[model samples]
Target: MSFTVYNFTNNDDVKILHQMGQFQVLQWDRDLSLAPWTAQQAWFASQMDVRRRQLIANLDGRTGVTLQAGAMQWTAGQIQATTGVKGAGDLLGKMVRGAVSQDSMIKPEYTGVGMLVCEPTWQHLLLVDVAQWGGSIVLNDGLFLACDSTLQHALERRSNLSSAVAGNEGLFNLRLNGQGTLVLESPCPQTEVLYIDLQNDEVKIDGNYALAWTAGLQFSVERSGKSLIGSAMGGEGLVNVYRGTGRIMMAPMQAATSYNTLASQPTS
Candidate 1:
């Protein structure tokens, strides 16, 4: 199908961040042109480094794309949407996973030759390659946006019970495996994200600042110090720990609050 998206790529306000395979991440550099009343607010937002971004999925007739439910903003050129459920058992599995992970219960799949655009958001958008993570990756809570349908999706359980309770994280995390591009709605921008590669080593984080990590890494929650008294004295109680050989995507700037919390607050 031959079609055109006028002003989408040529517009001065939009900036393309990353594009590969079936996904493209776009950012609105500035939104100060909206109106007189909001111009000052928009300028301040830009100065503070707040970004508004969106993800566009380009689909071919042979390959499909899966997106978080309610994420689709618009589509063009003969696209079809499906629940991506194979059977009753599949539906039950997704429902349980969604409840525990706090993800959308039903992710819709779009196929055919067309372009699917997701709703724009204030949070930063990141494009990840599954193959680069050794063919698999485990995601932190609520980072998933959209992914190529060729990847496999499953739940990865925390290494220990303490991780779920002490780390302030869920017992299960969403995992994607295979060779495909995964889109993430990150709490921080890619420039601020710290990537750590470990070889039979361990890394300890005082808070839930990790965005994603390699799938096989052992994750747990432990005291920050050798003893309880020492931990209290050190002013750190518990920390999220990752052990073994793998990689970690962390955002240290978000130690105090998440982007979602900041975005939800009323702005004068």
Candidate 2:
């Protein structure tokens, strides 16, 4: 019930918004604002610095806090908006990609484990800064996590976390390298996340929404080879496979799940 919100004082400084999902009073504005410039009190001012009334203002109103530019919100998997906030510079109608950039200084990139966020639709909030490379989060749904955390050295059970792969699925992984901020969850964010560079060639993915593929591609399971009384006597059968050249981010409606939903997300 809280995707975004930050109201400080009656005005002056803090105020971030985002909740129009199902809509009600509807709120907007994510253009950031600031204070301290000798405190005068101006409320609606976007990227326009003609030195406003210059006492000491530079580009971006000399930087204090002010947001409302454009081009932020992008949908490929799940995005449910319905904006309409008539307040400070209004129109927060889009831009849902918030989670970092209060100035971004995030650090810490090890002690990780297999990742996990396979369901709850994996939600969406990205502000990447993997902190100098070290990869492994392969999940187009089917998350695997084993890294990234801070301040909680408190005691035991810490074998690094994320380890689920015993039967069937095989290599289940989540092995990040350091520096972090990964909140991935895409049943199908408009598909297209490929990486097919093979030497064995043979790809097939009707569902599983691959997040990273290309190890030469070679997985099996294209069943229904005619048996079962000749295709259950006939529904035409013939469909149960995934050959491999290693690259699959399919879901034009693979049907694993998709109707484009929203209820604050997170149900898995």
Per-candidate TM-score against the hidden true structure: 0.93, 0.23
Q: What is candidate 2's lDDT per residue for 17-88, written digit by digit as tens?
A: 211111011112222334556234223322221011100001111111111122122222222222223334
lDDT of 2 at 174: 27
List, residue by residue over 1-268, the lDDT tens digit for candidate 1. Answer: 5888998866898888889888888888866447688788778878987767789988888889999999899998989999999899999999988998868989998999988998888777889989999999998888898899998889998889864686577889899999999988887888889999999999998887899999999988888899989999999988888999999999868742366665664332
Best by lDDT: 1
TM-score for candidate 1, residues paired by index: 0.93
- The number of clashing residue pairs in each candidate reads 0, 32
Off by over 4 Å in 2: 1-182, 187-217, 226-229, 232-268
- Model 2 TM-score, all chains together: 0.23
Task: Show the colliding residue pairs in model 1.
Answer: none
Error of 2 at 92 (Å): 34
Off by over 4 Å in 1: 255-257, 265-268
